[model samples]
Target: MSRGNRWARSLILLVILPHLCIEIYCSKPDPFAAKKKRMSEKVRQMFYHGYDNYMMHAFPHDELKPLTKTFTNSLSELGNLKLEHLSEKYNGSALTLIESLSSLAILGNHTEFEKGVLWLSENLTFDVDARVNLFECNIRVLGGLVSAHILATDSTNRLTKGTYKSQLLNLATELGERFLPAFNTPTGLPYAWINLKYGVMENETTETSTSGCGSLILEMGALSRLTGDPRFEFAALRALRKLWSMRSSLNLLGTILDVETGEWIEYSSGIGAGVDSFYEYVLKAHLLFGREEMWRMFQLAYIAVQKYFRYGTWYHDSDMRTGRATYWQLTSLQAFWPGLQVLVGDVTAANSSHREFYHVWQKFGLLPERYLLDHQMVHPTERYYPLRPELSESTFYLYQATKDPWYLEVGEAIVDSLNLHTRVEGGFASVRDVTTMELEDHQHSFFLSETCKYLFLLYDDSFLVNKNYVFTTEGHPLPILHSWHERLPEAYIPSNWTSIKGEEPKRASAMSMQICPASMHNCIHGNVQLESVCHIPDARDDHRCLSDEDCGVDSTSCRRRLCSMAGYCGQWRYH
Candidate 1:
């Protein structure tokens, strides 16, 4: 009885044990997957809500006045902060519709995207007698049109033959031709404002932001590539090259410049609104046009920005000539720095900066336009929170680069914040002031183009599969074509993202890898293994050492410094 009973019990126990193990391993449905799907749908609905409302009330206007269920011809009014010189006869260029074109394609609404494309091609014109900010017009209207054109004619897209005759390209070319006059200054740098119908307006302001003249290369260059007319690209490149030549010895450019004189006007500058895209564009221009010159410019400029403006992951305005900190403040636009950094493989610094921006966002339920870091309070006058997409844009890039669940969580927080505070029956409204959560009537076109697009991409990036893109400052995506690139940057290669670490990293260098200067900005957060090789000192105090014995470990990142190169200590190589 003992032998038979024992044999039966042992067999039964083995069978049950294996079944129990399988159950335990597969018990929980993946939380991240669920959240990703749920957040993706939420974002999709958010897009349609705003999109439908804009169509309903503001279809042919520049922007929706959501609070009034009306529209604003905000194009000429965009950078005209004083609302000066707005034409009484001005009509909208279907600004919101153009902005939504590429976004609709990204969201996989080809039918609706096609509809908007046809409408624009047939109806919209830049011929209105309106004075517009050259920079804003280029990034928003020109960027939007060029991007949507590419998407419209993409091999993967649907635009039945003959139905599309490169009409958008024609419109873009006409608009681009108009932009050429602004570049006819004594200096190649374009005027800050131009009249669409008559060209550069009489006595138009000679002053322009560095970004105004510097950021046109992408859209204009792409227009050249598509049109086979070098005028557009040549004009943009002339301006950019001229602007670069104007950089201070520190590789810095000021916030404002005089196009006619080729002289800097306002020398205090930061990587915020006035000068932000100048940095973003150079690197992306290299990627898109395969220009080695752009790559070199971007590399030197980035190092200078890191060395001077960056303080423990935060960047402040500095005298371009002196490299002395000028304005110790954070503008919401600075949130784009992390995302820009991600494109060039500066993830560690990017992560650290992104977290700081998110912390501020959490504090206000939105990022105010300006926060004076010295006083630790919002700027008294610049207290509004426009529906900016920078934080979400960076969040998307970080998630793509790292596959971290945390970025998805950040996107979730952003989506929830928009829904809770900004959503209105008309559309999403801007925060007039973060302190009171008071709302404004205007709905920015980027609220649809960048903010919603990035959050949606963060949660669902199927469109990015098998393709690489560099987003314009306004959040319009232009594919990084193989022909456009020389030898592709390793960063542009599609990663096998089944694992978090992705493909084996390229040969490490201070700029190519994340070995940040240890003086500030955590070199690698949550990277216990990385800590061993991440030391880069704030200063060089020692002479050449031929052996590893000369150098020691770093305290902050738990690094091991070594001696190898320079007839000096290169001991523990961080990269």
Candidate 2:
């Protein structure tokens, strides 16, 4: 062991050990990337399995019956409260094809999207004798068309651009014209049901859900922008404005109302099916159209929902007039609220609600249609899990906002659950009951349009890179383009995209470039400090805080709180 020998050994150790560490660091499996690619391909296969089967057995039909390997013209059946008045003579409008259009683009199947668009342009029609729910038709059909039309006309999509006329736009306008007659009511609120061929059906139910008349602005507004006809936008705006006027003093809206009388029919309200999309549309409309009115309505409505409806991230139904708790239960549709909250920069609260929904998803291996929170059990009869996309949709949004690997894991879990329980030889089937994992025959069009699409986008969002788009309730992607707006506000900034600030002024956020409410209090005022998913009463006697000095850092996140303009302490995020 001389000096020369010791020197040689030390050099060997230094060089070899450094190389080994580098190799280990580089080669250690990146589980996130690997899982993402694997799950993405799995989702693609799932989509083609359903899409190909629908083409084989259910093409030109409304929905596929996977168990029977057949089709059902289910357009009239959806949202029909009593499951009555289904027409025997009504043929399909190629419902499955129309729904799958945006999905094709999402999966990067340009050729297939082009082929489907061509087929739909040449063959599909809304001219059949079918009584359809206004909300269902607008979201699934009109939203689908407008979304696909934008993709078709975009040069980046590799679509057959030259040959494409505004064919989809033309069809959308015609369908929109038919929708106009439904708005001819005494109160400006459209009828819940309308006959495609003959307009509003005789003695059609005067009752409509808040969402029925309130969620039309996105589709109809896009139509006006594309076709240069204001009737569609004007009618939708009129209905929305009228519906806003009908809200209770507490800023709550009921689930159902009489279109003819402009009165509340069922005053109990919550962020569930009938009223969920109404809240979503207003916030998104402001983003899409740069309309301050929509933003004001949404800000007030959102604050009210958080104040009265939320209980430690679990929202329950309440009397719209009184703000009294009515139904202490959870519906799968309410899962969308977390995703909507993300758009308003309430990621902390969004994360809290999303985790609860994910926990429920884990419990059932799927999210049941309804869960009785009071009993901590699935609802007795509303036990079905209808391949809903809300959870995955929120998962994607959360991932976009946080870039956390955990959301990708959630996406993986969701993809696994679908493949294990719902995949059939023909197509994906709905869960008739979560308790038994029993399969239902009906394959909802949204299973393709939203569920699979969001799952795919979760794993691979190249389409969303450098682009700003707001997704409709049905998961249709509507780009927030400058050309589509009637008037672009100076303060407006597109979601997820960076804005340029210069001598020419433009809108910006208090915290970020995004123009959403920056403070948690501004977003929603109830429990100002959102540190955890569950509420734990602070030991202090007075919970109110007048300034940032009065508040402390969040216990869970260690993030600072600020005095919101509402004069309450609220959570703040720096990035």
Candidate 3:
């Protein structure tokens, strides 16, 4: 009796236990999978939110603050005296204008964008700065013109398409004509800089680095596409040949070079500021133009970056000749590396790098212009983060690729930190002290272009799902027309259009649409109040200014002030 009853019970228990295990574990989804999906959606939301706010409010409106006004007015005050070309003399102004215009175009701001284009038409010309340096001028005029042309013909804007086509084509011809003289060298590498009106320096050394040669693809290739001319593309391709020929045996490139002799000036390599974009452009040039050769070049360069320069935490520059590690500091420009990594299908690496970089931002409340690798300290002298979105940009791409929720959490944390620390009455400001988490009231143009654009895209990539959006070299999104019939020509279109094909559309044009939600404005409300004080040493006086007069004979006196003010002079003596 006992054997039969026990055997029946054991049989029942065995059958039930296996089914229970399957129900508890196998039948239920993996917890990690659920967590990853949630993280991915959050990342998407962060990008979309940031993108919408930027497109609606920030991009359409120029900084136009007192500080920016002062900067621009000072430049305008320089008049024609400051060398009208894109030389170092005018690089700052040209860069500023280019960033602004690029941001506007990305946001699809037709009215303001047309104004910017008209301003360029009236003020800038191939000949205005003809005597200016060649490469700088080329980047400014050729790059600027091609980028503007892309915006002008953007199918989304539809306000002034063909109006600029003739102008843009003529400008492309002029740039192509100007760049021809630089290609006369036997090595095919152009001089670092050229005069627009004149030819290359006969004795100019051909020792150009990757960037000097690599950056030409966007401008020249765009010009080729616009004008239906092959010469533009040929010139850029020649430069690529010269630079690629000089790659170190390791396939890495140095920082600087002689344009005529083809000798490297600085044989250091990394995916940082000076050298980062060279790698970026190789891949992008292929993406934009569908060039297999450029793609091959990118594959080689990217492999070198991954194998040699990349660390678990960051990318470091190495000696070009020895392949030995060199600098490991976080340069201001290195911020774009993660985003570029995401673009190249290296999402896991990109996510790791992004997390490390965001950790720096979390510690400082904003990323310093540069960070020391060993101590994880912000470079005291270079503490300004100019509203760049490289980390956020990477987060956007990672979310897009992996659909991870952690990236959304990262994006939200970034937005919260930015609002809490950087947002000012005028707009977002730069960093004052990375250690102290202080703010400096100077907003950069990329706040709209890359920063806000990435944020918005984090949330609403769906907006771009059907649209062919190609970003500028700086990461400003460019509209790719799906069909010629859907194209928006610049001429004869009003500020608002009723329909794309006379079907009585819902909105006038993409330019007039509001991308951001109203709640985002709440995020922008704050003043960059000076909440912390630090005393800077003054050698002029032995005694610190407790009541102002104690510091110096000529100091203005205050009878009684808070210790906070006295702390500025290290004079807080307790009675």
Candidate 4:
């Protein structure tokens, strides 16, 4: 080679290499980044102003209405009780007892805190109701236990350390034991609902929607940690694995399935209510368990969701097999997507998605529960906002990630909307008409556990940042970890921390389980306790010397049944 040729090649390599390095190391301005930032700031400002409004105009200065009186009286009464039995009816009787305890704890109300403990200690029971369903049972009991555990451990909470430790441990054990029935299915996927008392239903259909099967991990997984029982976590993991295994070759899961056969009962999918928590559980399971496999599965599933479902402003499920778009529009449950995105380091996308949803909120003081796909019109009949904080939850995440004042502004806006439309004489109304901005009188427990909590976090975040708070599937904060005390520099507190009331001890008797029927046949039942039976005829002929018709008993049923019993029965012959 000649010297001049060598010099030219070197010059070319030098220029190209440097340019490549710059491209690799530096990210370009995401066209959506600026928009997200501006929108977030606007939201934060709105939240601040709204919070002021709530404090001044909306919040009850005195107990005037029945609901207000009930709430105030409940709090005051809860503070004075002496906790003793494991079954106190009033102080720790309702499913909302944990939230009540938490609220008081957050306020540093020692009287309420002590009463809550007394109530929980005396009333805690692990019995499931004959009519109670499985999912509700788990949420009330396991959710209560976990929330109470957080309060017991929190230094700020007035409850003494180990005050409810033994009872909590026992509660964890019992709750873990109760979850076994849900995993008794052939496919290892839980039934949509189960009866607590009668065990599982025999001859019962093995059908379940995504929400029914996909929302178990948080409570069960937490139980596993608290009780040192792997079975609870294992059951949740098996459900996850079973569901994942049923995904189409394109790596997409459908909306519903026959739990027994693992067949696609409903092909349509959306990032909404019935299916939203499946994605949430994947990421959160990994976070809690530190399992690499969970992370890998989440990465694959998340990438597929983003690649196939995402349009400019919304996400819809595509065909599980072909990756073709099936639905397009906003869902009330889609409000949580942005928060999930923020968790996975896609702050830019999270910001954009949140802004679009915020626009929906602005158009209506609160976002409607659902929207149309092609028209961008709100679903008229479904126009009530359930007072959910999913969008606000995402806004809080965006704010924490960017430190942009916009998130605070969004918070202020949400606070304003709630105060303006939802604040009744009661604590907060359950739902509101997006069109009329009229308040609905019902108030759900989550208003305090999730919605108000997020709003509080957006404004303050001191509580959240001070401890590593992991939110449950229901958007309830759990297992607050004080890791920051060791790792974070003294001068900088993560803006995500905002102090709210500590979670209160769950009343034992408040927990309820559903009662389902028992079957003799070899079918997987809904409730966890029933043993599986294989009633489907075997593919292999016991009577060997038969004609083709006798031998040709459909293999599909046999295969499906086999798979259903085992949870993950490998592949299926659908045709």
Q: What do the candidate models score in CA lDDT, each in turn?
A: 0.77, 0.78, 0.54, 0.55
TM-score of each: 0.82, 0.83, 0.64, 0.66
lDDT of 1 by residue, 108-175 (tens): 99788888888887888888899999889898999999998888888776642345637889999999
Give the best candidate by TM-score: 2
Tell me how candidate 3 scores on lDDT: 0.54
Answer with 1 or 2, whichever has the higher TM-score: 2
Whole-model alpha-carbon lDDT for candidate 4 = 0.55
RMSD of model 2, in Å? 11.0
Clashes of each: 9, 1, 39, 67
Residue 428, candidate 4: C-alpha displacement in angstroms: 1.8
Q: What's the true lDDT of residue 523 in model 3?
A: 14
**Candidate 2 — which residues are off by over 4 angstroms?**
1-31, 81-83, 161-165, 487-575
The top-ranked prediction according to lDDT is: 2
Model 4's TM-score against the true structure: 0.66
